[model samples]
Target: MKTKKLVMIPGPTPVVRSIQEQMGRETAAFGDPDFVRDFTSLLDDLKSLWKTTGEVFVVAGTGTLGMEMAVANSLRAGDRALVVSHGYFGDRFSELCSRRGIEVDVLASEWGRIVPLEQIERALASKNYQAITVTHVDTSTGVCAPVAEIGQLLRRFPDTLYIVDGVCATAAEPEYVDDMGIDILLTGSQKAFGVPPGLAILWAGPKALARRASLGTIPDYYIDFDKWLPIMHEPAKYFATPAVNLVWALKEAVRLIKEEGLENRYARHRRTARAMQAALEALGFRVLAEADHRAVTLSNLIYPSGADDAAFRRLLAEEGVMVAGGLAAYAGRMFRLGHMGNIDAHDLVATLAAIERAAVRSGIPVELGAGLAVLQRELVRAAG
Candidate 1:
């Protein structure tokens, strides 16, 4: 039997078996009654997933398209948007806002640190912004922002819409979209949904819909919420051809999530992340984010002083496990491991074991089983 390479990248994480089986099914006709039912069921389940009473959209695109959809629908030229930037994805929100001619004020934090709530407050107080955008988890730096606190603060600015890029945090993280006063919560299907890449999922609250209705002329036709809203509500209605196969897969994915229970899924992600962190630390690897702000979905680890990123990652590949290299400032200097979506303790143990082997192959002296033993210990403790 051929060995299967373990995929541990952040966005396109491992796909669950059920979802993959659904994806393999023959493509259904767009207007077929059964297909419509399944697709609409997916949209309905999204509200439950995001924990929102608002409208949800599962469009055919990546997470970046979801971010653009939020920006294009909520703000127009001359409108002001305050973006809270902690890393790459946060900066992306600011860029999206700026491209639409929306005046953007960015309150940026150190790469590995979340933006302080007080700093966000001060920035909001400085201007009468129409919307505030934040990244729930910045994948680039493994930093989970203080979203709940920021959501609470948005209450003071009632008219301002709250937008969250949950591409890396949704489903895996504990998020209450309705309770957090989130006007728009957007994520991709690939991350915590345990599905393959190609769908942008989002929820829009009443305020955001009203804002869209108030726009003079929509800028982006494909991403315009107004265009997709009717189709989302009535899957039989056509705006653009929905990704039928991906929607079928999403239905299965959502079903699995419901079976697992959101709280249980969140706890599982946390436990697996803890195990990974413990094992990495045991091997003398330094994680980039501070302990308190580290994201549960992924870990950004700095290459040890004597380790080579290229050589280490190559050896890891030879061991039949795949991880990601860092992005932006940390690129080549660090690596990332994604522990979200269908991942469990055993996966971490295998990854750590591979790393231990890779360390030796890269000429870095590591006590055999140092990291693996720590991971197993942590997993046992977590299971209890």
Candidate 2:
């Protein structure tokens, strides 16, 4: 007999049985009419989820591909691009800009800290940038940036197109893309969308599209937003063969999210994250983020002094529970527990129990009842 496995890591989270079955269905040709209808409907649902009236494009690639498309299409060589770096993904956007020969300026906050609105405004005032990039939520540090505030600041620079990497924010929270004044918004199926990696979704406002057209040079053939956007909007046809199975799974996942109501879905994620944080704090673990700026999808917990982070994770794995270790500068200092899509109160309680068991096995001097008691109280509050 095998014990059940629980996946509490951020991306590629646990999938429901119905969605899994949909993925296992026989693959259909990209040009088929039924597949085209499904694909169009998925795009419409994605637009609704993104809260954007702009044209939406779904690329057959990973989240990074979406970021690359935004960078490649929106900026010409030597164009000034400012990236607000708070965690690993923000750093990646800066790197992409640099690789593309764009003049990149990064206003970096310390890991686990949110980027300040004043700092962004100052950057805009001091430089004539062609585009601005910000991560709506940094998965590495579990911090949520002030996108709406930044949107207001960007209004001061009419020439700068606002680009947001919303990989962890989409579906896990409400993103009013049009109202937030985002010119280029990028996300993927892996994180809050609750599907496997390999599909990227981008919603581009008219300004970004016009900028791409003015460039004259053809963008990267595969990642070109111009090419992909038409195909995604037109009756389904292939620029290259798509990942049909992943498309099917994404369609089903979007259906599930809409059925639950977007606000209700966000509330569920918030409740679960709050419960997990309450439990961790009770167990004497310090949270890495400030309460006001912490992301509701995940929590980053600081390890105790003199504790071996790698060994603690190993101990947890032995008990059949898997959690994520920190990324970049945070490696060896903190652990991350994701409470995003499809995770609920029962799942969080089970995770806390597993953590207690792991703590005891590792001789970490934890109180078995403390974490659970805090979690139970939070669940009760959410129910009311």
Lowest summed lDDT across 10 adjacent residues in model 1 is found at 342-351
Task: Give lDDT per model, in order.
Answer: 0.88, 0.84
Error of 2 at 375 (Å): 1.1
Estimated TM-score per prediction?
0.97, 0.97
Per-residue lDDT of 18 in model 1: 79
* Tens digit per residue, CA lDDT, model 1, 65-166: 999999999988899999888788899988888877999998888888877888888888888999999999998899998888889999999989999999
Where does model 2 exceed 4 Å of error?
Answer: none
